[model samples]
Target chain A: MSMTMTQKILADHAGLKEVSAGQLIEAKLDVVMANDITGPMALPIFKQMADHVFDKDKVVLVPDHFTPNKDMKSAENSKAIREFSREQCLTHYMEQGKCGVEHAILPEQGIVVAGECIIGADSHTCTYGALGAFSTGVGTTDIATGMATGELWFKVPSAIKFVLKGELQPYVSGKDVILHIIGRIGVDGALYKSMEFTGDGVASLTMDDRFTICNMAIEAGAKNGIFPVDEITREYMQKHSKKVYKEYQADEDAEYDEVIEIDLSKITPTVAFPHLPGNAHTMEEINESEKIYIDQVVIGSCTNGRLSDLRKAAQILKGKKVADTVRVMVIPATQKIFVECIREGLAEIFVEAGCAFNTPSCGPCMGGHMGVMAKGEKCVSTTNRNFVGRMGDTEALIYLASPEVAAASAIAGYIADPRKAGN
Target chain B: MKAKGTVLKYGDNVDTDVIIPARYLNSFDAKELASHAMVDIDPTFTQRLKPGDIMVAGKNFGCGSSREHAPLALKTAGVSCVIAQSFARIFYRNSLNIGFAILECPEAAKDIDEGDQVEVDFDAGVIKNLTKDKKYQAQPFPEFLQKMIQANGLVNYVNQKREGKL
Candidate 1:
């Protein structure tokens, strides 16, 4: 039977001849990860559930969310992971400087490979799907089950195919494409379904762009999002991957629940207004309709903190100062990305533009600390979710946009289009 | 198999961020997390809610983030069950893994009101709102899932498996 890429991967992992949506199957995992926030909780649950980890090497723990130890409690939480790693002899535990955001660090370190099943105690675990891997997020208890047994049950999810066509205009990117889709689909349109991106337009998206797109799949309630393995994927894997991996694709006659054709040329820079990623607006609408003021601009997170994103933000910030009324916070997704930004002089450009460059952390994005919003204040962010009170102060508003839009907004002290901002 | 409680109602898209908030995530203790459950959305929630209260909400309850804290907080705060029009996938799985009772009954969600006296029969998949005197049907759990829930979550289920008690 012809199968979608998701079905093919699940069937292979579950040791089945074929599988369909809604079938329950227990499958082995190639990798399972948990961050500090979830790791502390999962550890106790794992200890209660089993005597030892199912596979020490396959379990990875990264303390990125409250890294550098936000408080004594955070320090204690991180210490639980460190001690568990020692007790279990875990191999992939990452500490400060060595650790980055789990989603970014996993792919960069080659921990997630094509056609493998990966699970993390993080909603953004879908980010790995960009590399042609099948990945999804689970809760701490689910992570505990995966840790104890190296297996968990999955309900096969129907898939929605998005065939993107046409060339992207200047300032338009993968972020715009995803925002446009979310706008059309609403936050729950693809509930419990896989979102597969295909077509010639995908070939034009860089690895960074692909990562950004797949990372936000969860915003639209997708189980996972994937792109087929093409030359771009192969090249990225060759450079970063250590183990051999097989390429997988959906069969020609694979069944799909829905197919959406998107014209990239029709997309422009866009933003998701207060409280929901599905509340999208075009750059023209936001800039021309009214003056949307902002008190801050944040340019980092698993969603848009790659080196390419940094370079673009810096390009826009070049020779321009951040508006005196607005504060800008720049964070690289990982230590490696931070190094690259510094080496490429992007760090210097940001500093010269009066933007504060912070160390790699899930900082401000999760509202844990570093740059939380004050009541009634507004922020333009490159992070994925804008759910109410996502970054502190329920009354404060968050607008999600691409790096280009965020950078320009930082300079304008309000929501502004990149085209209108002087290069 | 059965639970009775007063209703603590909420609207659609009650995301994880507001359910427990990230500020309180540093602690994993269910009790600590519980103290703040629904505090942001309903400031008097912790004060008004007593043990064994049933939570009814509109569509997509627990929509953002995969943190189990959201469900754990609600469960610890004396929420006997959550009946919603729909749920985010991760939240649904997390609630089940933690042995929390959650049901999808659009009719019940629409028919029930805040402060309603309610009773649920887990095995029969029935929810009764005594205040409104309405009975609503829910999707029954499959046998396997029912067994897992009966064990009070995956941890206990795994423990039973390890002891050859399955």
Candidate 2:
């Protein structure tokens, strides 16, 4: 009978008293997002239906994935989005490298807020749930509908409480926690609910760690993943949000469909194997005595390519050259983060380390033009998901790991341990 | 709601990438999308599917991706309704917004088969697999959703409300 966090957020946003899971509700959207991959296709459909742009304030068009135009198709698509943003007089259209990723840059730019519903045409839109917003990704067509009408309808989802305790191990991080959670839940668990990650462990996570967890919520089949606001969230708000706002939390007795407890301390540095996040293996499971072949090592995405992620990768890669056989690709999540890395000389280290540092884009993460994998190539990536051919040729393999794992693997030319490589 | 269809059946984890693959990502037309719908996962889905065949699938149906085209492709493929045990968040929201019926029936797929003749009453939230004498619960549509479904789609629903025709 009690309103869960998502229900509460929806109620308040929709101007209602309360709502329940599976109950249809008309809610006001706090932010609606679309990326270059989806926006160019969906925006034209929106134009076909309506004569004018919808409310520009709520719309955010981000040019990521393929930025600065990778090819003719990508170039034209980015240009089309730019033209649409101009025609609509939208203020939130982030150009190449200006916004690292729709999922990353928006929150840092203060577009994502606590206790609201956000939609993006990019699946990674679920990443915003880290801030306690009920965000999810939709198709371009649905975005077109949202653009025409300022309102969208949602059936409140059953919430799954992921209660965490203990602490992350030295080499382990939030990415490990999520991978472990996924390992426990299996590929199909949390199929249709929001995974609200809470408990003592949550409070200990820095914003970046929390982002890493929420960013992969989609892989678990959850609509969104969320963490309650805390001091770290408050600090992030201070730096990002121009206009400060109040925070909301779940009621202590709030009802949930299911609750899971995770002992963060028990988690280890994990790798999502051959084809899915659920196929997890702890470092001990890997035969480190033997070498693995890798064609690429990418340490970024909206998932783990934040400022902290870059710093972590830089720490591992500094003074070490990427393996002769490996091509290390480092992508910053946002222009601000990219600029900061340049200012700190971290970008220079990556370049000097035999790494190919690219401009801010979702590049290689989605295999959208930049750094796409060839058939049979093996890649260690900080990005989430390893669905077959998800990154490129079906024969290519993607290993999901933390930035530390990815960078170290790049240097060793295989799936190597950062600590061992550091030594 | 102005829905006319029998029914079809599918299994779980029916992802969007399966509905319309990235190979066809360049095409934007609903008709073009319809032709390729489920062609990846169910190679015969488009060819064998008849007009107005509602699809009933297992839990976590339509997971992955934010492409609204997944729903549009189904609609274009003549899928009248989608009765699933569960649906990923984005697909569910997008389906309702685009005037597609997505009912949560925890036991829907378990009770029905591929050739089942089905009838769904949006107001009642009930699915009748007329062939098997099986029935499933589809949570009745809320006021907002009922109106949208009745209007045939989001655009029409909004337009009707704006014109004071609802």
Q: Of the candidates shown, which would achieve the greatest lDDT relative to the real structure?
A: 1
Can you tell me which runs of candidate 1 are displaced by over 4 Å? Answer: B162-164
lDDT (0-100) at residue B9 of candidate 2? Answer: 79
For model 1 chain A, give the 10-residue run with minimal summed lDDT: A284-293
RMSD, candidate 1, Å = 1.2
Question: For candidate 2, lDDT tens digit of each residue in B1-166?
Answer: 5353566678777777667765455545789989989874577988888888888898778777777778888989888888888887778767877777788888777787788888887777877877877777777766776677777667677667767898
Stretches of model 2 off by over 4 angstroms after superposition:
A44-54, A288-292, B1-11, B34-57, B74-85, B100-144
DockQ of each: 0.81, 0.37
TM-score of chain B of each: 0.95, 0.88
For candidate 2, lDDT tens digit of each residue in A1-423? Answer: 577777788888788998877777778877888877788887666765676656888888988867766777777878888998998899898987457777789988998777778888887788877777788777776677678776676667788899999888766787888888888897668766788988988877888898889888888987778888888887887788875454678889888888988888888788998777788988777755466679998887898878889988888888988889999888888888889899998999899998888788877776665678898999999988786656776678999999888888888888877767754
Clashing pairs in 2: A100-A333, A100-A334, A138-B66, A139-B66, A139-B67, A139-B68
For model 1, what is the error of residue A197's alpha carbon versus the real structure, in angstroms, after optimal superposition?
1.2
Give all TM-scores, in the order shown: 0.98, 0.88
Give one digit per residue, the lDDT tens place, for model 1 in A1-423.
888898889999999989998888888899999999999999878888787899988999999998888999999999999999999999899888875888888889888889998899999999989999899999999999999999988988999999988888888777888899999998887889999999988888899888999999998999999999989999999899887787788998999999999998899999999898999999878767879889999999999988889998999999999999999999998989999998999999999999999988899998988789989999999999888788989898999999999999999888988877887
Q: Clash number for model 1?
A: 0
